[model samples]
Target: MAGKSKSLKWFGKAVTAKMEQAQILGVNQTMAASAAEAKQNHTWQNRTGTLEGSIDIAEYAKAEADGVHGTWGARDIAYARIHELGGVIKPKRAKALAIPDPKKAGGVILVQSVTIPARPYLRPAADTQYPKLASRIRKAFEKASKKK
Candidate 1:
């Protein structure tokens, strides 16, 4: 029997692009949800609302050789790190740190440094949402595949 020869075309770039699109979509969605959760579920008292307002996607989703990358945090607020991870805060300019005296209505106490306890918001939120990341990516991939 005689058969006609057929040529196979490689579509590595297109396939990779589609996979990356799926990853980006998944990461963006998860990061947004994580940030929202962090803002809503925080245990810290909102004084000026700056911390909550600043909670956002510090880095947008992007496709990389390893995988999709993204980040969410209160990037602008300097104290965000201390609150999230727990740390000692020292005065940057002054000889001592001036912290609010919780006992008094309007008072502050001078100290060499203040130790802040960790009241994690972003990491916990991310942890809660990241469990579904595989599913999210799968769905995104399906969606991307359907697009023209």
Candidate 2:
């Protein structure tokens, strides 16, 4: 099928740009398997990994392959190794799921502002990990790197 026209080109730039942005935002990845599979497949949400909306698997994998993230030093690796084999990567390379926009708070909060606490989504720092402090800091790297 021919690609849909951007509102017949009559809607102009603003509308067209908004529509494009929406298109990307709506692009969901389901299982971390295929590009085709990623489309509209939001099953990843139930897992502890990055949000299905925030990242597609390719991007996540590339981030690690290129070493785009800030750092994952000894402590980070040790803490992560503690988790189950594959599960270690989850918290080690995580990102905040979309939080709710304050003005719009009804259904699932798809967007959120950074809060003082390490809100997970905000990628907040690790001030006190008494029981699991080191691990929390590592998770922060995973979450923060999602921004890059």
Candidate 3:
């Protein structure tokens, strides 16, 4: 009976270690999958590739008592929010916004504001990948338990 307790303790430690590793793997895989989905599935064309390049894991996963947590998105991009959620674009420091118009003389047009439609990238990516996370972690945990 005493030997069984010791064995259980060893198994507990092994399970904890394996769970931590699974957490790390899940976080990394989710981040990568989300980023790729956002980049590849978007319909909008990227000229500078700034927004696309900015999409990444903003906060890496940290193991917590409950589980692991992290964040992934386009960081340090001013237009990222506008592109994602979309809204009206108005001139900030000028009278009217100068927009490129090939048909115009100077290939530009001045307007009061332009309405942008919502083209969510991050949210959709997250939704697609979130469901798989649990399965991944559970599989890892099961594999660890099967080992000596």
Q: lDDT winner among the candidates?
A: 1
Where model 1 places Cα greater than 4 Å from the true spot, the runs are: 1-10, 102-106
lDDT leaderboard ranking: 1, 3, 2
Candidate 2 overall lDDT versus native: 0.31
lDDT of 3 at 49: 90
TM-score of 1: 0.82
Candidates' TM-scores? 0.82, 0.18, 0.80
Residue-level lDDT tens digits of model 2 in 42-147: 2222454323233333332112333232221113224222221222122223354455566775644532233322113111111111234334444544454355
Residue-by-residue lDDT tens digits, candidate 1, 14-128 = 8788888888888888999998999999999989999999999988998777887988789788888889999888888899987899999889988998888999998899899
Better of 2 and 3 by lDDT: 3
Once fitted onto the true fold, the runs of candidate 2 whose alpha carbons sit more than 4 angstroms away are 1-11, 29-56, 60-148
**Model 2 clash number:** 7
The 0-to-1 C-alpha lDDT of every candidate, in the order given, reads 0.88, 0.31, 0.86
Determine the C-alpha RMSD for candidate 3 after optimal superposition of all C-alphas: 3.5
Q: How close is candidate 2 to the true structure, as a TM-score?
A: 0.18
Q: Candidates 1 and 3: which is better by lDDT?
A: 1
Candidate 3 per-residue lDDT, tens place, 20-60, comes to: 98877788788889988998877678898989999988888
